[model samples]
Target: MANKAVKVGLLGLGTVGGGVARLLMEKRAELSAYLGVDLQLARAVDLEPARAEELGLAPGVFSSDSWSILEDGDIDIVVETVGGLEPARAMVLTALNKGKGVVTANKALLASHGVEIFQTARQQGVGIAFEASVGGGIPLVRSLRDSLAANRVTSCLGILNGTCNFILSRMTAEGAPFDQVLAQAQEKGYAEADPTFDVEGTDTAHKLAIVASLVTGAQPRLDDIPTEGITKITPLDIQFAGEFGFKIKLLAVLNNQGGKVEARVHPALVPHDHLLASVEGPFNALHVNGDWVGQVLLYGQGAGRRPTASAVVGDVLELARDVAAGVPGRVPPLGTQASGGRRLDLAPLDDARCQYYCRFAALDQPGVLASVARELGSFNISIEKVTQKGRQEAGPVPIVMLTHEAREADLRGALKKIDALPEIVEPTVVIRMA
Candidate 1:
């Protein structure tokens, strides 16, 4: 059996899929040598027939039908890079039921339907490896599941989306507006044509839900997380953040409070000297705090063809080793066996307490500052620092304030009242402090 080849079928021939195929084909000899068995790319399935010619796959290996690989008894593992919900979800379930080990980079599928997926794998006695799902080549899932297994993880803060990070980084460095930097990002292929998922914080939220599920052993619904995008972030806010000794970043945060979890994604003002603040461009960083291990920072190129493909192949090799050894479920997919059944109590955002950076555009009139402050005071929100910019004789000016720790509900209440005042012209912008 040691001499037998562990066959793999790849679904999708897009950017990530092409990279996976190239890595498997190019590194075939080395991988087979390392695993002590032939790791072969048995089939590659895609809708476009031209992709097969483009990737230069072996004549019999490329097919338009996914079932050719899924139904093939010889194939031991199926790697799904076809993102989004519909067919990817259906294909993954079918692969697991067939008792074939699966490796995928579909974070959205996992985030939304992970419990069902994990349960299927467990019942089938086959493993599902997703090392590339979250932090690309950073080895985040394996680290959290294996390296930090002994510790009770208390918190995890991450710069999870590379597109958002890239846009924000350019905005900070060039002092450009969001639209300008986003346009540049699309031109450079750092963002998708429709960047809603990344910019709207849904992508980051998906990753956060996965990470939080690993920590809490319960999968939280994607809709439950309070997510705020960076589209509203302006150069003015970025400048104000810098003035306050901070940098603005789209952050995914998960805090385990006595078994209850707080999962949120938003633009947070991180301290200038912090590790996460320094992570610029398309890079991603995750700061995980464990009860026993304290704090650990993981940084790397979060997403790309090479980095993500490297992670996908790593999972393939790991599963290949198990397949060769005739041990399919050697390691639990989520590091622990309690994942599918455990329930996590997710705390609402209203209960969350944190410092805030608030910007109010109000008319340059006397009593404006006091009126805003009095509203905040009534709701038990206290300002630690305040600055007013652009003294206009007939127009609204920016009034920025940094407040001490306050409950989210109170802050929202205060802001609601403050915005209704006659002196206030535009809605207040509020960003939480990390």
Candidate 2:
């Protein structure tokens, strides 16, 4: 029989999109031989036509109108690297509805409107592969969906955002303030000019929602996840964390608590010996705990053109093989049958229990520690260690404390009462312990 021909259409020609195009075109012969199908880069759509010239794509391959690719009957798969909700979502849905397979790295779109997209793909009997959405080239989604499918995943703790991880790692290494490190990250292209999503924990939360949904078979609302950023972390906090034998990281935490799932993103204090503590600088790590697998750590470059494109192309080839065989939906978008797994409820943040690192700026008075301790004790929060460093004759001094495991509600209540005290000068800084 003649080898089936599978054509791929690219929706964007930006950094990641360009990489995907280059790979698909450069490795066409090898890919075709591997899959026993003629894998072709059929069409590329981007607002900037100059991108095609820059990438040296053939004359007829580039088009300004997206409909050329979307409406093209020969294209068997659509690769959407357009990173947003509006046009990308609409375009992806259109492709799936047309029975064309999809490959995307849009974490935000997947996290926000995944149910509708997955349903559309399922109804059309096509597939949607999104390996690059979460951990760049780490293969995390596939590992969770295929490799660890036999094990019941109990928890997932990840350093999901490369921008945030870079900032935090710099802060820890140089003892620089948050603002300075963030500025450096932006200058180095690690962060955006307006990095609200990455710095404020929203980016990590989006990735967490996707991973949690895959683990529990329930689509979690992005707003439901409590997100905390690294904006307030200072050099003093990093120094104090080191003194306590811990390193600070912005972590995306997802735990399957009985039938309820706990999801949150925030700066966390990880012990020095823990594997996650060693993950630094534009790197990503996911520590997944499964009943049978015990503990699995998937670590790699979280983002960038080549790494992200590597994942996107891998998904393209996988979906291409299925397309060539005329067998779509061989594997569901999220790894499980849409209606197969039980939906898990989201656990409230208030009920979360963990040790905490609290920093208080208070008047350099002898009675300040006693007053703060009394308030924390009132909420049933016990301190495991306390350190009062440096005395500012006129300004407030630093009081850092490490607390035993306590409910988040009780800790918040204690901090609220303590912040209201006459001796306290600034709001408390709380970093959860892993």
Candidate 3:
């Protein structure tokens, strides 16, 4: 039976480490039966071997030094759940060079040094399983990389970050503000010590870049993806969006326009009826549009102990099986080379047009509306409807303008000029119409 036991070396015993212990203990027989290989935690690598044992390490199998396992001739697979770039990067690189298959859930590591790691693995003739990198335990990365490999992906978009989504959902549901909801989320451990990555959209951007690379085989630079956060999204804005039959969502959108791809993240006005809008709570969802599969929505836990650990273990099993079968060099969800890939600006937004919702508060004065409309017309932007609200409880009078389809640059330019107007009471709230 090819010794139904696959000896695995594990790295890091954090929250996910404990979860991996539970999963390996519980699902060992099932996994072994499935692959005809007993997955054993042959060696565990952690800073403090005692702490790793605290998580219930099997007897006689422990290592304070991860290098021992990396160099251990008996180990068949290396499962790295360690989150970071430096040591994780060096560790994965070393293991791959040693011709050991690696399985990891480090999105940051994968996002930054994926091409280098993937190419090295290819050269070493080993599989690198990272199914949990994008959608936590959802297996989306593997699906995109293997199952949908043949399909020509048209658009990849989603609410990929849980922290930001939770805050935004609270702002919409309870009519609460951003900072307040954010504080609560932090208190609840939904946010990080430095929530900048999650709130500022960089986290989602990282996932999008990885997904884009997988779909396009071209690793796009992080800075190339134009990103906007949800910090500016107000409760009133969310309310108005709902009233107008739209739901607000922070979406990381990737589109393949001809030979190029455009990746961007921003607070968007998605129709309530659309599946993305229905996604609520501290959950993550991805929408992949393919020529063959059409459109598929994958929704699940974006992070945390068991979910992330399950993904890591799943990757571990895949690597174990692939290595045993002597079929290594499995490509990642994204086909990334160390240095050959180049990112091309897709300029896809220009191709996809939409109506815009603008809120401009001007003083109670005549010719103000006409002047604002005229300024928008300069860029060939047309206003479909103009609604002048009576008066705000505080501040300037409110003037909401709904504009017809126009390019984003034109809309932005028109808003900038309107902001400079003397008649305008305050800065406008402009959101893309659903």
Candidate 3 wrongly placed segments (more than 4 Å): 331-354
Pairs with backbone N, CA or C atoms under 3 Å apart (clashes), candidate 3 = 4-37, 4-38, 5-38, 6-38, 214-334
Instruction: lDDT for model 1, please.
Output: 0.92
Model 2 agreement with the true structure over 71-115: per-residue lDDT tens digits: 999989999988899999999999999989999999999888888
Query: Which is the winner by lDDT between candidate 1 and candidate 2?
Result: 1
Question: What are the RMSDs of all candidates, in order?
Answer: 1.3, 1.5, 2.4
Please say which candidate is ahead in TM-score: 1 or 2. Answer: 1
Candidate 1: worst-modelled 10 consecutive residues by lDDT: 337-346
Clash number for each model: 0, 0, 5
Candidates ranked, most accurate by TM-score first: 1, 2, 3
Ranking 1 against 3 by lDDT, winner:
1
Q: What C-alpha root-mean-square deviation, in Å, does candidate 2 show against the real structure?
A: 1.5
lDDT of 3 by residue, 69-128 (tens): 899888878888788888999999998888888888887887788778867877677778
Backbone clash total, candidate 2: 0
**lDDT per prediction?**
0.92, 0.91, 0.80
